[model samples]
Target: MKDDKQLEQTEKDKRQKAIIEMIQTGKYRRQSAIVDELINQDFTAVQGTVSRDMREMKIVEGKDGSSCITTEPLQDMHRNELQRLLRENHPPITKILLFTT
Candidate 1:
């Protein structure tokens, strides 16, 4: 048996991989129902968190059908809220750099 931390990391990796595969196969759109099924199939994670994980995986909501991970959206900074994040959490770069220097 693995230690708790190792087990956690393994689970995280598995969850991430599963999420990616599902998104690629056009499965991420199914939502809570599928998540519930995964949970029953021994995925020791919550459905709510799985939904959040989809966001972290860069899965985009589509109009025609389900969500999928798109590298284009990931690369296109203009289409995302990244700028708002920068504006909201613009840390003191000078202070950080001063410590490093």
Candidate 2:
């Protein structure tokens, strides 16, 4: 049921996720290395796509000057923050209202 554009975007997202995991492992230190790994994994991506994905994801150099993918995608970052806020703050307020107040 997915259209061509939708399928293309899905594939792009999958490739980006795999890149992030590889970067996190510190094994793919260079863009070419990442591309090679992706190819090995059967993902058809080129260096340019990988470069764009890194830039879009806000991947940056670490303190040691190594490529790092520490920033989560904006959607993921927002979701995580929302979950953290709810987990840390919401339950206590509910408990106070139901049991103490």
Candidate 3:
């Protein structure tokens, strides 16, 4: 993680990782929880922001197939120091470049 002051918003890699970890850990679920966590860190993360972050992080629905968060490995997910990539649509990859690590 870089200096918190250097980050202008939650799009940052560190922030993204934190969001991923939070979702995986079940600390971020309902809108209010995410908002409260962000507020504690002086960031105003709204419900929409949380949703966008989840999407960007490629936070996937669990194997149970209900709308839930899961760290279940993406069959095609690839992660490097730069990013985590996922195939958002059929034929494997199209239209979306999400990050998840």
Model number with the top TM-score: 2
Point to the candidate with the largest lDDT: 2
Residue 20 alpha-carbon offset, candidate 3, angstroms: 1.3
Name the TM-score of candidate 2: 0.68
Quote each prediction's TM-score. 0.55, 0.68, 0.46
Reference-based TM-score, model 3: 0.46
Error of 2 at 7 (Å): 0.4
Worst 10 residues of 3 by lDDT: 81-90
Ranking by lDDT: 2, 1, 3
Error of 3 at 59 (Å): 1.4
Write model 3 residue lDDT over 47-67, tens digit each, in one string: 787667667656765555323
lDDT of each residue in 1-101, candidate 1, tens digit only: 44798667557656666666666666446777558656766887677778777677677777876776777534533433464357457854654334553
- The lDDT per prediction is 0.63, 0.77, 0.53
Pairs in clash, predicted candidate 2: none
